[model samples]
Target: MDFYLLLWLCPLYIVGTIVYRLFLHPLSGFPGPKLAAVTHLYEFYFNLVQDGMFIWEVERMHAQYGPVVRITPHELHIKDAHFYDEIYAPASRKREKYSGFVAHFGTPSSMVTTIQHEHHRLRRAPLNSFFSKRSVVQLEPVIRENIGKLADRLAAEIQKDEGVIRLDAAFTALTMDVITHYSYGKSYRYLDEPDFKLAWKDAVLAASANGAMLRHFPAMLAVSKSMPHWLLKKLDPQAAVLLEIQHMVRSQSVESLQRLQAKKEDNEKTNTAKTTNNDANDNNDDEQAKSIFDALNNPSMLPPEERTLDRLQDEGQILLAAGSETTAKTLAVISLHLLRSPAVLARLREELISVMPTPISTASWVELEALPYLTAIINEGLRLSYGVTTRLPRVAPTEDLQYKEWIIPRGTPVSETSYFVQMDPTIFPNPDSFDPDRWIQAAARGERLDRFIVSFTKGSRQCLGINLAYAELYLTVAHIFRRFELELFETDVDDVRLVRDRFFGAPRDGSKGVRAIVRGETLL
Candidate 1:
């Protein structure tokens, strides 16, 4: 009798909540699926069980219900193109990242995951200079060297494997090595691996997966963060990898700290006057290991709370992964499109030859970036790949958002994704094609197509790795195309199709990477 009574009461409670949400909720008038309005499970099934289908579903919802849709009981998604600038404006104090949106990395402490605008600014201030245009130009030799190493590895692979090499693995190795070396002043050198089998890349993806998992089941973050690795491996081995990385970063931080302290102590011992140390240290940068560790640990203006070993470790892991993975993904996009369309590839190669004209013995990164056709190819790649496949939610905590007719109340979550804007048929005709000419033509006609490509997003909270990613993409693409003549080896469009939006937009399965043969000799 008691069980029967409980069952009746549970139905009554669910129906009551649904009815209230339908009519009385603040967002009740907004158009969306009835199931979504009632509960979050509608989104959970799509995002989790379906592997990030929620973003796609939002597009579908917009198609059915117009531009604005109630994505969740508490969040609203806007699909209007005209409203993008207003939403992502440089002056908008509404730059607070949605807590629910960022819970994935389980890194609320990270600058990428920080929710408060002022706090995010404070956290991001120290990282800005490291990725500046001047900084990237200064580091061009390091980037070019990494790209050259990959070419050497690729040439060796081509020789061994009948000129068939897996470009996905090769590009991943190059990016992982470059970012790690740039950030920590040393790299694991995944490019040096026989066949470039980077086990650490698997760890990086697993960490991203863990972050996505944290978004839906947030309590799992606490458990995942605190659980012992030995025990974790028994149930879920992938998650244990993330823990190992954290531990590894912690050890590195301690070592770096000790090294810096020893240097300071040695300086003090050698001289009675401390005034000469700063001048001497500036003149002799022999012990200067320029890395994220050095930059972050030694910031004089950052708050004390943001300057812990754990904070540094969390940030280092985030920077290394974010910097490497996204750039690699974009390069893969370029490789896929270029392979599919031989004409576009031919035009690009011709342009490259016209500029260098001497088999590309040596080319400046800045000069390579300035070439008209090369810039066009890079732009098209960025647009086609769409940096992140999903939208990043921004909440205006203190003020209402106005979009033409509708006045969205304060604290409402709003978002726009590159996949939607970059692929908009009205803006980009034949949106699916890999046409470098689109960018070139648009430039000639004076179209503001540049604004449409939100690969790095817009406004203040934009990617900190923008300059670095550009430098890598520009150098790597120029280096590869100039040095090697590649043909698709057992590779097709389906292999590199948009299968999942996890971590970032990923290619379809059964794709053994961007496999190709090298038919030309190294020119740079």
Candidate 2:
């Protein structure tokens, strides 16, 4: 009788607690579903069970319950185009990343996962110049080289078989090669792979499942960072390839550290022999161009904590993955749209021909960028891609967020999605259609459509690889279109459709990728 009474009491107690949370919590006043107010598991269901559908569900919540709706027991999601800038504030503001997101980024050491505003600033400072516009422009030749290799391969294949190249595979290979070479002073040559059989891309995609699990349960992230390699492989075999890549990154970082240490010892021995301390530092382009490895290893610039071997490994992984994946997807999407829309392709090629009237290889990025129609096409591509297609949560630990009359308290997670913001019809008109002319027309009207496009997000936490991504897109688009006339083959809208969110959006119905045949002669 006593055991049965306790069981009945437990059920009653749970219900009572939930009733209190739904009706009497600090955020109870906020407009949202009663179930959402009761617990965060509502979010967990959509994100974990439904496979990253929570962002869309949040949008639906916004439709039903205004802009500011309680998404979790402790968090509020605001999907307002007008307030995106305010929500994702400047780096100067106290915008700490929500703890819920730390898992997706892999490690707390990476600046992307750093929570504190000042901490992120200190961590990100060392990497600023390496990814700057000047740095990327200087690195364009290297970019063109890998892209040139891809173009050559495609051209040769077309001549041999008149085959349809998978744009996603081609783009992924091109991007992976460029970024690996850029960051580690070597290329994985994913392009060099026959049919691009690099399993690393699939491995990266699978990690999205790990990310969702980690986000829902933070305990996994801690274990992931500290757990032994043998054990992780035992649990999930796919992690072996992922871990192999990370180990490769760690080896590069360790090599840089060793080189730095050897130089220091040599400097000391010289000073002792000569009885004089000559502190000489050389910042030549050769040393400067050694890739992001040496830059992050600089002791004077980066703090000791941020420069740990483990931290360096995490940083390199994030940089390589972040730098490559999004760019590859965007380029694939752009190529797909261009192939599908012949009129758009015709107009773009005419502009390219008018500007250079020569081969694509001979034309510099500066020349390609100068073409108004080309620039408009790239902008439209960025707008449509929505590269990181999920809600990025930012919490103001010291300040309350004001969404109209509602005062969301400090430490409450406030979030927005790139999907809905870029898809907002009020701002984009026909947001679904891939129309480059909208941008060209907007430019003619002097409208700032660029402000509304937040694929890279905004303010302090913006993507560091923006310049590099831009360089890749500009160069690849120019080279491919200038060299070959691409057209869709056995591929349709469903192949590239944004079906499920895996952090990076996945295509519907298991389409291999955007497949198209390569035609025409190399423009050069």
Candidate 3:
């Protein structure tokens, strides 16, 4: 009996030791806490519960481990800017995105979802026209008009309260309006009419909250994915929220398509009239120019068999989701920082004033783009806030890629957390402090700023709406400051806190939300 028991115990001990050596023992040479290599669930729990400490944790690991640190058995976290090139370079092997963070909503993969290089190329081809420089320039008027409406609305509020206004709701409204316009055209005015349906608002809020839960608990998502859809919905409220969001997007997309068809019909009629009069040559110039919608609708522009209406509509929703929430949150954070730093705010206002005079009806994009201080402030806000703090995990395309001394095997999920990159003390002295001047000085010196900038991810998979984002931020912030001085009313600047979300950070604790008292109502 004793000999038999010993035989069983010997194999069990060997298995345990092998597991340790494969994970924790070898990773000990690199420097992360033992628990991190042994199991990633602990770190995941810390990230979920520790109120924005995962960034600091990753920074500590990078400081100790040089550049590459194993965060889990199958994962490596990288910090070196040089590695960014290797990781994102087109020539280098590509990696699949971590399954936990992927936006899998039952629809086929879009550009943002495609993991394979070939698939990504195919996915991005059709959508490229919508984000091209020319496309952005053409859409500038739409963005400017929306910004003007936002300013006018805020000014009306300021007039009501003696030049004081709460900017939280106003900014949210403005971004939603701008993104929706670009996504579905001007037919759907969610922002113009003041009354946003409470049910729709609740659905959006619920979807955001549930999304956070799903990211934190990947196992739950996996389990739900395996379960029957009807049963899953009954068991999990998050599933229901996800379904509701998809439904909302689909319904809105259908309406947008109908509107697009109507517009096409009107254009055809106008063209026919011009041709009848033999004025076709002159009227060709008068033809309504192609909008982003027109570009998406063009079959010749997209690859064969990929230009289906459903695919285009799905892409449109993706743009709306990606553009709207992130832009609004970034704007809110900037407003909070500006209100807190009165001197910074004053300097930015001065710059805006120099660029545009009082009684400004319309300022050209060229004029807005020329404002150095304005661009610096926006860039700085994005850096400090680093609103999307989560790791953008990409999978290794092939086995045996060398990261430092360690060979990161294929099928491993590798990522660098932007939160850590943004907070590097060497890169930005006193990284926590909100200093727009850092960007200004960097620009003046002509130092390579791209190393420090990853507000949008780098390389081929970079944010498609980057130009649009810049245009929107420039116009919106410039116009707002040109007319009104923002002052923090209820919330203390230091009291500002981030409400952690799955994909991004938002304001926490019903922080009466960036209430800015507007000063100097009339521009003139």
Query: For every model shown, what is its TM-score relative to the native structure?
Result: 0.91, 0.91, 0.80
Q: Give me the overall lDDT of model 2.
A: 0.80
Error of 1 at 17 (Å): 4.0
Q: Specify the poorest-scoring 10-residue window by lDDT in model 3.
A: 195-204
Runs in model 2 lying further than 4 Å from the true structure: 1-17, 222-244, 259-289, 522-524
Question: Which stretch of 10 consecutive residues in model 2 shows the poorest summed lDDT?
Answer: 277-286
Point out the higher-scoring one by lDDT: 1 or 2: 2
Off by over 4 Å in 3: 1-31, 38-40, 47-66, 90-96, 99-108, 162-166, 193-209, 212-239, 257-298, 301-314, 359-361, 396-404, 494-501, 522-524
Model 1 lDDT per residue over 1-524, tens place: 99999999999998899999999987898889988998989888887788777778888899999888998887888876667776776735557888888877755567888888888878877677778899889888888788878877766655655657777777888888887777777776888887665566667776775656677787875787678777888876656877777777778778878877787688666554546556654544344437767767664647678988778887877887788777887788799788788788778777777556655455777888888788888888888778777678788788888876777888778888778888888888998887888888988998868888888888877888988888888888877877676778888766666667665766665557677887666443
List the lowest-lDDT window of 10 residues for candidate 1: 280-289
Per-residue lDDT for 270-367 in model 2, tens only?
A: 55666343433332212442677777877777778777899988898888778877888889888888988989987887888866586553577778
* Candidate 1 segments whose C-alpha is farther than 4 A from its true place: 1-16, 161-163, 270-289, 522-524
* lDDT at residue 121 of model 2 (Cα atoms): 87
- Top candidate when judged by lDDT against the true structure: 2
lDDT (0 to 1) per candidate: 0.77, 0.80, 0.65
